[model samples]
Each structure stands twice: as C-alpha cells, then as structure tokens.
Target chain A: MKTPLIDNLQYANFSPAIFEQMRAGGVDAVHVTIAYHETFREMVLNLERWNRWFEDHPDLIFKGTTAADVSLAQKTGRTAIFFGFQNPSPIEDDIGLVEICHQLGIRFMQLTYNNQSLLATGCYEDDDTGLTRMGRAVVTEMNRVGMVIDMSHSGERSTLEAIDHSTRPIAITHANPHWWHVALRNKSDAVLKALSGAGGMLGFSVYPHHLAGGSDCTLDSFCAMIAEAAARYGAEHLGIGTDLCQDQPDSIVEWMRVGRWTKGIDYGEGSASNAGFPPMPSWFNDNRDFGNIRTGLLNAGLEIAQVDGIMGGNWHRFYQQGFGPA
Target chain B: MKTPLIDNLQYANFSPAIFEQMRAGGVDAVHVTIAYHETFREMVLNLERWNRWFEDHPDLIFKGTTAADVSLAQKTGRTAIFFGFQNPSPIEDDIGLVEICHQLGIRFMQLTYNNQSLLATGCYEDDDTGLTRMGRAVVTEMNRVGMVIDMSHSGERSTLEAIDHSTRPIAITHANPHWWHVALRNKSDAVLKALSGAGGMLGFSVYPHHLAGGSDCTLDSFCAMIAEAAARYGAEHLGIGTDLCQDQPDSIVEWMRVGRWTKGIDYGEGSASNAGFPPMPSWFNDNRDFGNIRTGLLNAGLEIAQVDGIMGGNWHRFYQQGFGPA
Candidate 1:
C-alpha cells in the first residue's frame, strides 16, 4: 500500500474545494468535527447534510465508517471523511446516543469542551472533578460500541481518569505538549506518557495558539518538537490532527466558544484584539500543504519510517484498531 | 406501589380500542414489536407513528424508555409502550444501529425471524450457522448499549452462541419450550436451560400454533405449563410475552414472514389449510383477559408471589437490570 495519509482531526469549513485539496495532498482520510454544541437532533441534521454531500460528491469523497475505508480511498484516489464531535452536547443526557452517533459514522467524541459537562470537567474549569457517574458509563458504552474518546479539551484529572477508565485506548486528537508550549490547551508530559503507555495516539496540533511562536512558528521547530515526542513516547504514538479551521467566518468562532451557554463573548485562544481565527502559518495553509510537513520532518533528522508513521501510517493503524469493537 | 404488570412482548394492530383494553387489563407496561423486517429508516417511521400514538392517547398510553417508566405508567394509570424488534433486519448489516434503536427506546431485538439473516440463522433455516462475524460484534454492541438480544425466532446454535457471547443476560422475548409444543419456532429444553442458567429470561408465547391444543388451549393447561417451567427453571426467569397479534389483517402475516425479500407468500406457522393468524385462545383473546390467566395460575396451585413473578414482576426486574450499561 502507498503510505496512507490521514489527519486525525480538523474542524474545517468543508466544501468541494477543501475535498479537492485533500485529494491534491494525497490524503486518504480526514476526521472532521461534525458537532460542537449541537443537540442530538441538530447533529442528525448535520449528518443529513453530510449524507447529501456524500451523494453529491461521490468521486471526491465518501463517508468512512471503518479504518479500512482509508485504503479504499487510497485505491480510488478519493478522501474518506470520518465524522467526530468536539463536545458531548450531541448526546445530551442520554448515554444510549453514544452508540447512535457511532453508528452514524461519528468515530470520535470529546467528553468535555471548555467547561463542566455531564461526563467530565473541561480544561478551563478551576477544579477538575474528573469523570462523572454518567461519564464513566458513557465511556464504557463508547468503548463497547467502538467510539474513541477524545480528551483534547478536557482537564488533566478528567483526562487521566478517562485514560485509566477506558478499556480501549483514548486519544487527544488535537493538542501539543505543555512542555513545548505553555498553553492551557496543551497537554502535560504525564498525560501524554499515560496516553502512549496505554497505546493511545497523540495527534500534534497546528493551531496557531498551540504553536511556540504563534503564527510565526517555523516548520523546523515544529518538526523538532515531533522528534522530541518520538524520543520520549515512541514514534508509533505520534500523528497529526491539524486543528485547521479554514475558510470559516469570524462569527463561527463565537458560536464555537460560547454556543448558547453565555450572553457575552468568550474569546478562546484569541483575545479581544484578535477574536477570530488567527492566520495559519505560510508553510501549511491548507490540505494541499501537507507535503511541507513531510519534507520538514525528513530535514529534522527523523527516519523515513518514523516520518511516514507520523504523517499518517500511525493513524491508519489506530483507525483500524480503534474504529471497531474491542 | 402495586406490583408493575409488564408483558415482555406483543405485536398487535393497536388502536384506541386496544388502548382501552390495556387500561381495562391493568397492564402497566408492554414490549411492543415495532419492526419485523423493516430497515433502520423504516423502523424510525414506525417509531414516529408510535410517537403520534403516545401524543394522541396520553390518558391510555405513554412511551416507555426505562424501567422507571413502568412505574410511571402505573401511577398515571396508562400502559407504558416499550418498543422492540421481532427481527434484526432493522439494523441491517451495521453493528452501530444496535445503540441507535436502543436510543429510540427499543428494548428487545431478535437475531432472526424465519430465515437466515446477517447476524444469525432463523428457525426456518435448515442449517444453523450460529452467530455471523457481524453477529458476534453486534452482540457486544447490544450488550453495551443495553439492547436485549432476543433469540425467539433464531435457530438453536445461534441462540446458544448469543447466550454465551453476551456478558449481559439475553432474552427470548416471545417463544415457548418445544417440550410443550413441537412448533419449530418453539425453543428446545437445551436452549431454555442455557438461557435461564445464564441469568436470561424466557417469555412464554401464547400464539395458538405454539400451544398444545391450538386455539382451544385452556388457561389451566397454560398455567400448568408455567408450573412445569418453574420446576425446571427458576420463577425469576419466566414472564408473559403472549405473542398476541390481535385484529391484524391477513396481508400483514405475509409481510411479517416475507417482507420484500420474496415475491411468493410464506405461510409461517399457519399451514395452507389455516393460513394468516390463527384464532387466539379463548381464555386470553385480548389484553382485557389478562386477569383470567392470573386466576388460572392461582387455581393451578402456584403461590401468589410465583404467579406475580410469572405474570410481570420478572420482566419488571429484568428491565431494571438489563436496560443500562453493565
């Protein structure tokens, strides 16, 4: 098989153009966030919209329900779109809906976004009470139904609880190590160690705020961080989840951060001076620029196998293992 | 609290008259088969129709999503209608739909109807292949999502495998012991032994074909059979599933057996001479006659507690244990 190229997470402004760019980048599969704060019915409506997209764009993209679909996309020269949720709002109070969303091809879901939820505490919360009663049950249900738990936006205590409680591996689909960049969203060495120790993959993020020097972060520096992660946690556990919010309107950031919970603006990552999507680094602007990272990793002293694994091979393997019943 | 009276399974041509009969019968809850061979989308339409029924008949009936709803219905003096499937066709080939149907309040789903399905072999299939690859996975998913695996219409080997594989107790939502009646649809002693031994429940079927004397089967004899079952298996494993098909048109029988799979008609339990639904036994012709069985059981020398367990308490307890994550 041609080394499969997969991006574990992205909440992109998806359109035919973005799909075409995925094809241009030789990307076989992309896990896309289909829900942030949408209710179950609203998430279903979003799925309906995606169903229409699949029907409309058969040659460009196909809905992927399993990791095997990655190879299918590679052979057919199309992109396999895997659905995910940035928050557990779609499931609401019902744990039964975890399987329903998984059935609808949602392969991943975060227990928390940026606050306390029925399941877990989020990163911004002052005290992380960890996984709630419902959260623990939902995790077992999700594991049984082959849905991966993503703790990217969850607090440390909650994330640790999830990694320990989940019988199957859980992921942090988009974030860097706090050791590299001291952002609240970035994970600690302890979390990453426990994650990889439990066989879970960590997809390094390319969001501007997650980078060391903001939007001015160099490709060499980013690749160097990857090499360090590989040295510490083993190369097989590393992958990419570019956190790309491309072509989105500034208003969407407000909806993403505030949803319907607050009346005032909550500028996430971006302050009042820059309250929207920060400019993406020139080196990796869109799906078509994925090759730049591969080249940068090769120049940053990574072996070809390690670089290939980080690019997509690792995720392809993870998808194969994670997208089915344990 | 009055002991909740719940029927484990029924498929009737429901109307306001039936609701009135349920009220008169004092039935607190009932597991109603919503799909025979319908696909997931088609099953959803059936649920929508049921939703309208709940809205239209609020005084007589309400939708039951949990065991607590049974008590709610008792307090409200209306029957709580619990959804189920007589066959796994609603989920088709996807293991994910087990949870989706559960989310829609479906409590029981049979592995097969009267022929081989993707998951398991039906009673009518000559060769029993047991659980298919998808069937094993679906069982775990069902176990996780709290959807009961029903083997009422499935073949012996497949039924045994399901009992073995499911960590949670499985159910035969509507079927009788073959020792009582030689109908192929009736389960064998081996199957019942395995079922009850594994903490599973066996809901006795009252359909004419599965009874010793067909439509003339007496309440005394039916209660005597229950007494025998209680001797063989614990009373905790027994409940009423009636298999009542009241007021259904003849065309529905054909649809239930054949669906869209074949153009020709299938007689199912009814032979060429007695096609369509056999006349219901006189002692239990409708929901209003449930009290007759209760009296008969009392007359048949069973304790009040055992009779109550056989009537509904067993299923009420099952609903409590079986409707949540293990």
Candidate 2:
C-alpha cells in the first residue's frame, strides 16, 4: 500500500468539507489542535464539538487514539483525527490533568505558546527559565501517561530541558529550523539536535511565518529545507507537520495569542500592516496538496524511501512507539 | 468463585482504612458517588482526588470502568471503584456532558437529587412535572453511551418517565420501596414495577432514613423486606447498594442537602431536633458488615441462588448487559 499520509498538526475550522478534502488527499491521519489557550472545561467543550462531528459524519472521519487507528482509517477509506493542544492552558495549574487529557485522547501538548505559562517560558518571554516546579512534575506525569511534550512554541532553554528531562522521546511537532527561517517560532539548531539525537521528531512547518520566504516560499525551497534537515538530524526523525491553520477565522489567531492572558492584543507573528493569517504558498493550500510536498521532496534529491518516510511513515512509527504508557 | 460483592452506591470519606474495610468485607467493586451538587469542574476536582487515591492504593483499590473489572478485582484481591453522580448537576445544562462523562468513566448519573434540577423534578419538589425536555435528551444520550440513568431520589412521575424513556434498562441504585419504608427517597410502587418490568435494578438502600424504623431496624426486617421485593420484582432484579456514607463528617451531609442552593440549613430527611446525619442501623455501619446481610437473607428463607443474586450477581449481569455502547 502507499505510505499513509499524516499531517502531524493542523487547526482547521473543521467541517465535513475539510474532512472530504482529507479523504480526497488520501490523508489517513491528522493531529488536530482541539485547544489553543482553552481551560480544561473549555477544552472539553471543544472535544464536544469534535464528538458531534464524529457522530454526524462517521463515514468521513473518526477519533484516533492509537497508531493502529491510522491503518483502520486507511482500510475503511476515512481519515483519523487525533486530538492535541497548542498550549498548556488546557491543563491549567493541575498536574492531574496531564493524565486526564491523555485519557481523553490528547496525544500532544505544547508547554508554552508565545508567553510564560504556569509551567514554562514561551519563546516570546525575555527571560528563559527552563521548567518551573509544576513543569517538572507535569513532564514526569506526561511521560508516564504517554502524552508527547511538544515544544514548538516554547523558549530554547525550556525545550532543551524538556528533551533531557522526559524519559520518552519528545517532538517539536510543527517547527522549522531557526537557521532555515529567521522566525521566533522556528527551533534553534541545538533544540533540533538534542530532540533528534534523543530519538525525537521534527515536523517541518508550512505555516508562512515559519517559512524562509513567508507565503512566497516555493515547494522546492520547503522540501530542500526538509532534505537539509534530514541530513542534519537523520531521515527517520524528520516528518511534515505543516502547521496548517486551514479555513479558520483570523480572530482565532488572536485568541491563540491573547487568550485571557492580557487585556490588550499582542499581534503574534504579525504586525498592524498584516494582522491576520497569511496566505499559504500557492502549491500547498489544503490537504489535497500533500502530493505537491511528496513530489517536491523527491525532486529535492531525496530517495523515494526517504520521501515516503518524510510524508507520514516516520510519524506513524513515532505514534506507535511513544503514544502509550512508558 | 463466590458472587462478587459489589456495592452499587457509596459516598464514603474514602481512605486506606475504608479500602481495608472493603477488602475485609470481600468487596470486589463499588459504584461510588463522585458528585452531588457539584458543577462539571467541581466534579472533576472530586475525580482528581479519586485519581490520587487509585494511584496511591493500586493494591487495595483501582478505578473500575467495565463489568469485567469486578472479575479482575476479584483475581487481583482489590476493590474496583466505579464512579457515579447522585445529581444531574455534574452535567449542568449540557446534554453533551453525558457522553463526555461516560467517556470519563462515569457509569451512572441521576436525573435529579431531591430538587427541581434542569433535567427533572426531584422527590422533594412540590409539583412533579416528570422529565423535562433536557431530561429526555439526556436519557437518550445516556442510553446510547452506556451510562445508566439512575432515578433513586427522583419523584414518582419523573422516575416512571425515565423508565419508559431510556432504551436500556435504567436503575434505582440506592432506594428501598416506599411502601415498606415510607420515605421520600424511596421508590413508589408504580416506579418499582415499571423499573422491574423494564429489566431494571432496584438496589436496596440501608441508609437509616430509608429504613422502616430508621436506626432501630433489624437485619431480619431488612432481609424480609428484600424477600418481599423479590416476590414482587423477581430476585434477578435486586441488589444491595447500602449507601454507606462511612466516616463522613456531619458537615458533608449539609453539603449534600443544601449545597450553595440555600443560605440557611434545610435539615433534609431530619427534624429540627436532629439536624445532622441520623445513626445508621445497628446491624450495618460499615463495609465489613456485608456478611451479616448475606447470612440474614438466607435465614429469611431465600434460596442460595436467589440470595446470591440479591448480593451482587444481579448488578453484575446488569453491568455486563448495559454498560457499553447500545
């Protein structure tokens, strides 16, 4: 069978139309962000929405809890949607919520978004304190329960600390290399090296702000960057996350940035001149364009086997290896 | 392989001591009430406490999610603690919370708890309007999701409505027959008949207020009453719930009856002369005394199989048949 197509991260304004696009693209699995800056109760409300969607369109998509669910969806000709969080707000101050979120099928959780969380410092913070007292407890609990610690939006120190502290392999689920892109959201070489060296993964992002040329970055440029990342950090640990925020309202990005943390707007990743979600590169706008990425990776002097693994095989193995009890 | 000792209802001030008592009593499983008047968030806090207990005492007790857990608990020499709610307050006004609560291992939820909740009228309400619109929706959702719809403290009309409304067999997890007990918490004859006719269970409660003569009632009286209930509703429809609120302070009863609803004390099920929890029956005070009831049932002239069913076999069958997706 063709390699199962998986997007390690997405935060779409989900609907049946998008689900249909997933099937049309042969996408077996997509880790969808159910909470950005939501509290535990608010995160439950988001899950309720997904539950409704799953009930309404059982033939289109289903909630995926294990790596085997990808194969199940593939055999059934449907897409499996896994749940995740973009920030630690969903867990709030409670370390118990780490297991609770895992029980609810939250496979990935970023410790920080763009500011200091109760657990760790975000990339936007001036001082880079690694992990708080609660952060260490939460990391051990998350490791015990099989929830991946994603540090895509976390500070450099916090990311490195989490990699060393976690007993299980972690992931920077949707970040490019800082050397490839001069963006605060991208990962530094040290973070990437520590992550990959520890059997972790680095999913290359297609989100404009994390790309070299923003929305104008070409398919060749993106894939060649992935080829370079594979060379630096072994092809087995490289995959695609895309950081796709498909069809979401611009106001959502504001919530992702400013959720109850401040009384004023922060305008994350954008300024007054461009204060909204940037357009996607022409070659990759939706799920249907995963083929462009696969073709581009092949043209970037990567072997067919490497391209297949980068597309989704690597992530499928990661899901199998780490998304369960330690 | 003796019949599993399962208490279908409890709200004890749980600890290692109580769990030790459960082991001494040879209890295999318990349906523990995790909420009374708690909101969804507050109920979660209660679950977090239980999570801590389960973590700390895995050898003595563990969280039970399925009927098979009873057998597992028996094999492992531990008590499996199943979760339930005595009121609809945990779900608030959201029907979606039914499925979410079920997913979180909530096996049972009451429609009301001695007041006019958003779902249905409680036994304490003046006018019995039966099931509200939301109550109907919640019952169907609960049925679909394998959560037992419990109406142990509901009004006659509301209980009858629930018995008819739910496709799966509902339960009165902790109440005696009103004809025998003359208490507001007890089920009326019609409610009991309908419940039994629909293959439901009536877990006889030993709470002092629900007894024929309160704390003065004898073990023979309780066992004889169980015999009469078996004559009317068959032995396959009976079990013991006990409602053992062991080691709880009197203040906990106040919270159960008047939680944030009234500014002044309501003195539920008690007179002004005695405004706290009444003494439990002399023959039954804690988990270690279940053996007395088993012996009393046999002396009350029940066959061994009939007595065994009343102990826990009936509820085990009900759990296996009902606690899964319809």
Candidate 3:
C-alpha cells in the first residue's frame, strides 16, 4: 500500500464537502478535533452529530477507533476520522471519564488548551503551575486507557511534567519549534528535545500563526524548518499535524478561546482586527494541497524514506503503538 | 463478614449526617439514587457533588465501584455508596453513555421512573410501548458495561421485555410484590417469578406507599411478606431496596416526577393530598433502622442463612456476578 497520508490535527467546519476533499487528497486518516471547551454532554452531542455525518457520508469517511482503521480507510478508499479533544473540558473534573471518553472513540486529549484548566496550566497562563493533583491521576488513567496526551496548547512546565508523569509516549500534536517562530503556542527546543528523547512525536503545525512568516511563509522555508528539526531530533518522531480550521465561522473563535468561562471576548493570539482564522499559505490551502508539502520536503534535500515518514508513515506507526491499552 | 447490610435503592437528602447514620446502622453499602430526571451534564454535576461527599466523609463513606468494595467498606468500618439512576435521563439520547455512567461508578439505572421515557414505558403510561430501538442498544451496552438494568418503576410489558432481552440478569431494585400490596409501583407475580427464575433479583421495597398497611405496617408483617417471597422465588434472589427518600424537601418530588419535561406538577402514583414523600413505616424510618428489619426477619421464622442472604449477601454475590463485562 502507498504510505498512509495522515494529518494529526484539524478542527474543520466538517461537512460532506470536507470528507470528499479528504478522500480526494488521499488522506488515509485525520485526527479531527471534536471538542474545545465543551462540557461532557456537549461533547457527546458533538459526537452524535458526527455519527450522523458518518452515516450521511459513509462512502467518503469512517469513524476510526484503532490504528487498524487507518489501513482499513486506505483499503476502502475513505478517510478514517479519529476523534480528539483540543481541551480536556469534555472530562471536566471527573477522572473516570478519561476511559469513558476513550471508549467513545476519543483517541487524543489535551490537558489544557490556551489557559489554566483543572488538569494543568495552558500556554496562555502566566504562572505555569504545572500539572494539578487531578492532572497526575488523569495522566495515569489516560496512559492506562491508551488516550494520547497531547500537550499542544499547554504551558511549558505542565508539558514537561506531563512528559515525566505519563508512562507512555505522548504527543505535541500541533505546534512548531519556538526557535523558528516565537509564538506562545510553539514548543521550546528543550521541550521538543525532551519529548522526542522520550519517544514522543512532534506534529509540526501549518496553522499560519505558528509559522515564522505567518500566512506568507514559503513552502521551501517550511520544509527547511522541518529538515532542521529532523536533523536536530530524529525524522522517525516527526510528522505533520496541520492545525487546519477550515471553513469555520469567525464567531467560533470566541467559543474556542472564551467558552463559558468569560463574559467578555478573549482573543487568543489574534487581536480584535484579526480575530478569525488566519489565511493559509499560498502553497497549501486545504487537504488537496498536501502533495505540495511532500514535494517541498524532497526539494529541501530530504531522502524519500524520511519525507515519507514525515508525511504520514510515522503517525501511522505512532497510532499503531499508542492507540491501545497500555 | 457479619450479614452485610445493603439498601438497594435510596434518594436521600444526603449530607454528612446521612453517612454517619449509615455507619451507625452498620450498613456495608447503599445503592443511592444519584439521578432522577437529570440531563447528562446535570447528572455529571451530581456525580461531582458525590465525589466531594466521598472526599469530605471518607471516614463514614467511600465510592463503591465493585462488589469487593462491600467487603472493603465492612473491613474499613465505612459505608460504600454505590450510585444508581431512577431514570435514563442521565444518558439522554447517547447509548455510548452506558459505559460512561458505569465508569463513573453508577451501578444501576432504571429504564423509566413514573412516566414515558426514551427507553421504556413507566407504570403510569396508559400505553406500554416497551423498549425503543435506542433502548435495546442501550440495554446491550449497559449489560456489556455491567450497569444493572433496574425496571423498578417501568411498566409490566417493558419490564418483561427488558428481562427477556438483557443477556445479563437485570434487577428490580426498588419495588415490592403487587401480590402482597397491590400498589401501582409494585412488581407483579409474573415479573418477580420471571426475574428470579432468570437469575435476576427482587429488592423488596420498604417504602410505606408500597406496603400493605402503609406507615402502620408492622415489622413482622413486612418480614412475613419477604418470607413468602423467599418461599416462592427462593431466598437467594431476594433483598431490600427500601426506596428510602428521607429528609428531602416536599418541592423536590415535583422535580422527580416531572423534571424538565412538563411545566406543571405531576402527582404521579400519589394524589394531590399525598404529593410529597410518604412517611416511612414506624419500624424502618432511616438508615439507622435497618437492624429492625433484620431482627424482624428472624422473628418471622426465616432461617439464619435465608435471613442473612435476604439482608445483603444475595445482593453482594449478585454484585460480583453483575458488575463486570459480561
């Protein structure tokens, strides 16, 4: 089979069109964000809605629970949509819900989003208090249940502590090297090194805001950054998790950042003038443009095997290793 | 360990005082009703509150997740509080929540209370539709997850269908036999026979409204009724689920019967004259009075083994067999 093309993160305004595009792009699997600052019930409702979508678009996409589903999706010519939570709000304060959410096909969960959560301090928190008591317990449970702990949007201290606490390899599913671009959401080289050293994966983000030149970043520059990271860390631990927020309404940013916690709008990273999804780079606008990334990586002097691994084979291997009872 | 005292059902006005009473009564465990007619989020909030209670009163109580917890509670000199739901509202429309509720330590859940629900028909429904499509899926999921299906307040046909459909033995956790009292909420002879015949349990109710003489019923008479049931259904499948709704405000009954489904009060089973909680029988009023019934059973000519099994041993064994993946 052709090397599986997987994007480790996306929170698209899902529709039949998106599923069709996923199939068109030959994307074998996509870790779709199903919850951000949603309560448990609300998250279930979101799953229910996705269930409807799966039923409505069976030919184009299928719900993925195991790593085997990626190959199944490839065999069936469909995209395996793996569920993930951008924030741990779906579990709320309940530790037991970690397994419950896993049982419901949630393959990944972040301890925090962009602010302080019950579990840990988010990237936006000034104090960075690290993992809470509940956070430690939840990490144990998550590791036991095979729910990948994604510290993509968590503060540095909490992220490092989570790495130390979790017995299983975790992931920074969507972020870039802060050495390349000093975005708050990007990971420091020390954090990235610690993560990769512990056999964890780093899914380089294509979310413009984390890019060195934002939306105007060139394909050559992006690929060069990936090449540098591959040389620094190992290419086996590198993959793409394009933090695509395709076709979302501008208003959803408020819900994503503020949720029910605030009466006033909190524009995270983006200000009032640009409080919406930033423009995609000219080289990659949607799932269909993933081929450009493959070509760009090769043009940046990476060998075929390393480029193939960075494209999706690494994530497919990670999924096989991580998405099961530890 | 010394005839383990277990109340199969209760919706008490829970406080530290109640926990103290449970320990004072030497109750090993209690299947306390945590949700009547709550949505999934509301039910989670209730669990969160119970988690606090477990934290605050660890000396008197602990959250019970398995039958082993009964012996643990006995060894620790604390009551194990097992959770139940009097209605399926906690799951709402998602069948996935069956395992979720089980993970959160909810051991039992009624298909319906005193009105028509998404799962099955309650006793008050003129037309008993039995289990819906979602109901069958939920039942199978519940059985798989080891969440006991309690048809205590469900209609006859629905109760029978549930028993027939469920691969694992189900329970009528809080109802007396209609042959003895003829109350609307009591189980019929056919249900009791079918239940116990199929390895299910019949938890005899101590709620005054289901008693032959209401609040005036003697302990001897109640025990005699249980003795009769033992003679009919065998002593091993008999237990007590008092339905002890103690210390709750009169206004709370409205929420129990109507929930958010209706704008007006539903004086279900009880008339307007008797809308609130009926007074408990003089013999058994609170958790502290469980010993009275135990003594009354011995006085009513039950063998020590039969009496002990009827008290709690049967339920404990049932818990062992029932609370795991079937």
Candidate 4:
C-alpha cells in the first residue's frame, strides 16, 4: 500500500480545480477548516457548501470522518476532506454541541482563535488564562465524542493546560515552533516539549507569518526546520498542515481575523500596509507541489520513512488513535 | 459469508434497546424515516438525536448513507441506520434543499404524506393530479443527487408519474400491493408493474392496516403475500419494509397522521375508535422476529436464494444501484 499523504490543515476556498490538484498531488486526506469564527448555524451553512462540493465532485472527493477514510481515499484515488474548526465559535456556549459537531463530521476544533473565547485564551490575548471551567468540561466532552481539541491559535498556558487536562492527545493542527519562527501563532519550545511528551501532535504550518523568512522562505529552510523539529521532538508526531489559503479573496482574510468580533480592522499577523494573505514560497505553491517538500525533506538529511510520516503517515496514525472515543 | 439482512423502512422511537434488538436479530442495515411532517430545522433536531444515539452506541449502530455501509455493518457486527423521509416537508419549497437533504444523508423522500403537497397529490386527496411542476423538477433533482423518490403515500397518478418522471428508479419504500390488501396506502397492480418493469423496488409493509388481516395477520399469509408478489412483480424488486413504529406512543401516531396540516385528527390508517398505532402481527413482533419471516419465506416454497434476497440481499443490490449520482 502507498503511504498516505495528508495536509492536516487548510482554509482554501475549495473548487474542482483544487480537488483535481489534490488528486494530482496524491493527497489522501486534508483536514479543511470549515469554521473559523462562524456561529453554529453559520458553520452548518459551510457544511452545506461542502456537501454541494461533495455532490458536484464525487469522483474527486468525499467527506472523511475517520482514519480509515485515508486508506479509502488512497484506494479510490480521491481526496478525503475532513472538517475542522479554527475556532470553537460553532459550539457557542453549549457543551452538548461538542458531540453534535462531532456527529456533523467535525473532527477538530481549536479552543480559541487569537482571542479569549468561552473556553480558553488565544495567543494574541494579553493575559493567558489556562483552560477555563467551560474549557475543562468541553475538553472532557471533546475527548468523549472523539473530536480532537486543537490548540493551534490558543495561548501557551491554555494549550499546555489543554494537553494536561484532555484525557486524549490534543493537536496543534497548524503552527510552527517558536524556536524556528517567532510568530505569535507559533508554539514555544516548552509547549512543543510538553505537547510531544504527552503524545500530542504538531502539524507544521506553511502560512507565511509562521515561517522564519516569511514569503521568501526557501524549501531548504522549511525542510531544515522540519528536520530540526523531528530531531528535537522525535518524528512520530510531526506532519504537514499547510494553512494554504488558496484561491480565496483577500476579503476572506479579514473575515478570518476580524469576523464580527470588531467594528474596526484587527490586522492579525499583517499590518495596515499588508493586511491580506502573503505570497507562498514558490517551491511549495499548491498541493500539486507537495513533491517539492518530500524531495526537500529527503535532501535535508531526513530518512524516507521520516519524510513519509511528515508528509501524511504520522497524521494518519494520529487520526487512527485520536478520532475515537477514549 | 452470511447473507446481509436489511429492513428497508421503519420509524421507531429508536433507543439502545431497539438497536440491540436489531443486532440480536442480525439485521445489517435499516432505512429509518427521520421526517414525517417536520420542517427543515425541526428535522435537523431529529438528526441530532440520531447522532446522539450513534455516539452513545457505536458498538450497535452507525449512520449508513451508501450501499457499502451494509457490508461494513455486517463485517463490524453493527446495524447501519440509513435515513429517509416519509414526507417532503423537510425540503420545504426549495428545490436546492433536495441536494442539501441528500448531503445530510437522507436517502429517500416521499412526494407527499396524506394530503396534497407542493410537489404531488397524496393518496388521501380528493383528485389525483400527477407530478406538479415542482414535483417533476424535484424528481429530476433527486435523481441527480441520488435521493430516492419514495411514492408510498402518494396518489396513484402521482406515483405513476414519479415512476415515469424519475430518471432513476423510484421506490415504494414501505407499502403493500393493493391487490393483496385494499388500502389507501397500498399500491395498485399498475403501479407495482410499472415499478418492477422500470427496475424499482417494493418493500413489503407489515404496518397492521396494510396487512389483509390487520394486526393478527399470520406469518404464512404474510410470506405467501411475498411469494405472490415475487410471482407477479418479480422477487428482484421485493423486500421487507415492516413500517415498524416500535415503542412509539399514541401521540406519535397522531403526529404521523395529523402533523401540522390539520387541527383535527385524520386517522391515516385507523378509524376514530382505533386512532393509535396498532399491535404488530404475532409472527412479526419486532426486528428480532426477522428470522421468522426468513423461515416463513422458505416454508412458503421459496428457494433459499429467493429467501435470502427477500430477507436483505435484494435490497442490498437495490441500494447499490439506487444510492449514487445518476
């Protein structure tokens, strides 16, 4: 059997072209962020959009809810689109919605999105309160319902507390290590050590802000960072989560960062001068260019198995262990 | 390998007890009616309930959308609970919601219940107008989206029109032959002939009033009716639907019969004196009694292959053919 290739995080405005590119890239599964800061009903509308895509492109993709779906996608030569939330806004204040969202085929939900949510503190918040009371209950509920507690945009204390409180191994679905790139969204060394030590996963982000050299970051630098992280964290929990905002209008970035939370603009990673998505590194432009990363990882002194795991195999294993009731 | 066992239709107040009985009966899959006269939002609440059941009892049941789920259910020793709608109220007046409902895993949608709808004339209507403009559009849309057009409670002209209008073979998901038992819900010879001739399916209903002798109907008589149906309509198009309203209270029956359409009770299949769910025949008490029908079919001089098909294999083949983009 071919090793599965998965992109564990993306927020692309998906189309048939992207799905075709996924097939060309031999990507078995992709955990697509269906909700960033949308309300419960709004998240359902997003699901409706995806449902239309699934109907329109059955030959290229289908909804993926389990690890076995990766194998199914590989066998069928299609991409399995798994749903995730970049924020816990979809659940609102209801703990019951954790299981409800899981039933809707959502497998991952970030506790915060660069601000204080009902559950936890975001990375951008001044004061880092750990897991709130609701957060602890939601963590337990998420564990019970097989929905992974994602902490990609959450504060360090909150992320650490999530890793501590969750009976199931949580995930930083997309973000880099702070030691590699000092972006607010990136994880610190302590957080990385704690995450991996607790059998949690850290999916490397290719979003420009999370990169050391921003848009000008080379494939070699990216691969070297992967190699370094693998060396430090032991490669088992490493995988790619290319937060690729492909084909989306700059307006979507505003929605992602701002999303009815504020009247005026809050330029998340970008300044007023550059308040939009940045250019991708040329070598890793899109899914079809995943070959470049694999080649780069191999050239960066990583073994074939390590490269394979980083590409998708690790996420596959993580999905197997993580997306089921504890 | 054991032959798959499927019940093509039911509307039980499903619980762990019902799911366990389904396992005890060795049923692989069941097509459950999730909507009777519920509006779109109300139906979502019902889906939430089923989702809870699935989460709570993963060992016993899981949602089934495709035909492959049957084999998967049998292999995993669980029942695949497939979804359907006995009425098109959930879709409201929007043709787009057809595909949306299909995306939400609704496999079957009847054009009407017991009154004239936006789509077609119900069986109890004064005049039988065929497929409406919306009905034809919905039929084509349903075919394209792979949701079955169930004509169980539709008027004769409408049912025939649907059988002809549908690019894909429509289904009388839970109804009996009118020749065997004269009832408003039972289909006529012409309808069944057109259904089978066009590669459609007839899921025999044991819904008390549809049976010749009501609740006291014998196993021999029921299986003999199956034998007669196989003789007339061909065994390939026949399977069990049961219409098993198991564990539902009289109030639920009231809802099924007189949703929000009328202020007064309609008593769909029963009179004012008998306006509640009737007791099931002694031979077919619940899902656990499926074995009795299998034996009854064999005793009624059907070959083992024929028995197997009626039991579930035929419905499995129908499901495979029916549930996909056409």
Question: Using Cα atoms with residue i matched to residue i, what is each candidate's TM-score against the true structure?
Answer: 0.57, 0.97, 0.67, 0.83
Candidate 1's residue-wise lDDT over B1-326, tens digit each?
87878888888998999999999999999899899989875676677677668757889998897889998998889999998898888787766557656756888888889899999999998999999999998888888768889999999999999999999999998888899879999989999999999999999888999998999998888889888988999888999999988999998888998999899878888888898899988888888888998898889888999989888888998999898856
Could you tell me how far off, in angstroms, the CA of residue B319 lies in candidate 1 after the best superposition? 32
lDDT winner among the candidates? 2
Clashing residue pairs in candidate 2 (N, C-alpha, C atoms within 3 angstroms): none
Docking class of 4: incorrect
- Tell me which of candidates 1 and 2 scores higher on TM-score: 2
DockQ of each: 0.03, 0.65, 0.09, 0.20
Clashing residue pairs for model 4: none
Task: Give the interface-residue alpha carbon RMSD of model 4.
Answer: 3.2
Global lDDT of model 4: 0.91
Better model by TM-score: candidate 1 vs candidate 3? 3
- Per-prediction backbone clash count: 0, 0, 0, 0
Clashing pairs in 3: none
Q: Pick by DockQ: which candidate is best?
A: 2
Per-residue accuracy of model 4 over A1-326 as CA lDDT, tens digit each: 88899999988888899999999989999999999888876687788788878878989999999999999999999999999999999888877778768867999999999999999999999999899999999999899879998999999999999999998888999999898888899999999999999999999888899998999999899999999999999998899999999999999999999999999999999999988899998887788988999999999999999988889999999999988878
Q: Measured with DockQ on alpha carbons, how good is candidate 1?
A: 0.03
lDDT of 1 by residue, A23-99 (tens): 88888999999999998766766776776577589899998989889999999999999999999998888675675
Q: Is candidate 3 or candidate 4 better by DockQ?
A: 4
lDDT of each: 0.89, 0.91, 0.90, 0.91
Ranking by DockQ: 2, 4, 3, 1
The deviation in Å at residue B16 for candidate 3 is 0.7
